[model samples]
Target: MADKPMLDDTEDVALDFGAEDELDRQRRFRHPVAVFFHLAFRVASILVYLLCGWFVDSFITSFVLIVILLSMDFWTVKNISGRLLVGLRWWNYVDEDGKSNWVYESRKGKLKGLTTAAESRIFWLSLVVCQVIWLVFFFGTLFTLKFKWFMVVIVGSLLNGANLYGYIRCKMGSRKKMTGVATNFLGAQVWRSMLATATASAAGKE
Candidate 1:
């Protein structure tokens, strides 16, 4: 008898078949489910922070809950949601020299050719809006002089800032790549023109 397929492998294959034409693979922003959860998680994180601080009236519990939710949101957005929504992914790692380096990867080929206007608009707008909201929350905490809440806001803001930086860097990389292509195209055109001129000069001499 043939060996049976592993349940895990079967499940994976089934899921792949279900989403065979994943929009992200086409570099299109068509993930209603992912986008829904992405926004839901972000909104829920802040709501929970507020609930713990105001309604529950427990400093320790509030602080812990806020930190955990924020952490989850950070990971989900950075890894899963960003990739699904924008076709961009980023990570940072420390080298043997103890220097940290960030890597930004973007989908290329036909997926890249599909373009990024819609994704970029949503991605950048979300970042800006999140930063602004977090900043407002930071000031609100400051008014209350709650050191713990302030700390939470600071951490959340830093995470948002880092995301913004990574995305901007990724976009810059795309721009540089495009610029290189344009330069090469112009150079080839110039070369072709030079060849034609030389050919004409030779014909005249002949």
Candidate 2:
């Protein structure tokens, strides 16, 4: 009788471990869809910024131009993921059995699965702030006297570096890591102001 109980308990433990392994497999094989969006957004932002600088002779206001560009860039991504995906699919996680699961099954994980309204807003706002800063620095250099090409080159390099660092960090490290040292070195004051403004707006609305 004692042996029988011990054998049953061992079998239960093995079954539980198997289920956990399956969950881990699912996580490791996370869909590449989100990553695709990330790359597409970055590439498109860079191209748009370059094109705007090349053309648009009437947009003398750096602030206005930056605001419009950043707003469109940020809000578009946020809406695409949060509003469109969430509304269309209601964005649920399902087990192998096709049963609904929580947004995050466990706290220790990467906090993955489904963009909530709050998360979407922050993502939108943060990217906007970052892009605005880069744009402001770029325009400020363009408008500066002495016309030092070196300065613009330096700032652009720094911005790209920060973006690269941030990208790598997000891919290899945690989602919340602040690896954007280049942005700190070359980004303009507008970025800070915009971040503060966005935070206030989000807080007030909430």
Best by TM-score: 1
Candidate 2 stretches with Cα past 4 Å from truth are 1-31, 47-72, 83-129, 132-206
Q: After superposition, how far is residue 63 of candidate 1 from its true place, in Å?
A: 1.3
RMSD of 1: 13.4
Q: Residue 113 CA error for candidate 2 (Å)?
A: 5.0
Error of 1 at 48 (Å): 2.2
- TM agreement with the true structure for every prediction: 0.63, 0.29
With a 3 Å backbone cut-off (N, CA, C), the pairs that clash in candidate 2 are none
- Over the stretch 1-206, how does candidate 1's per-residue lDDT look in tens digits? 99997676443333565354555534565666666666766677678866664588677777777777777777877887777677778899999999999898887776764434565566668778888888999999888887767888998798877887776677688788899999999999999999999999999999
| Model 1 clashes, total count | 0
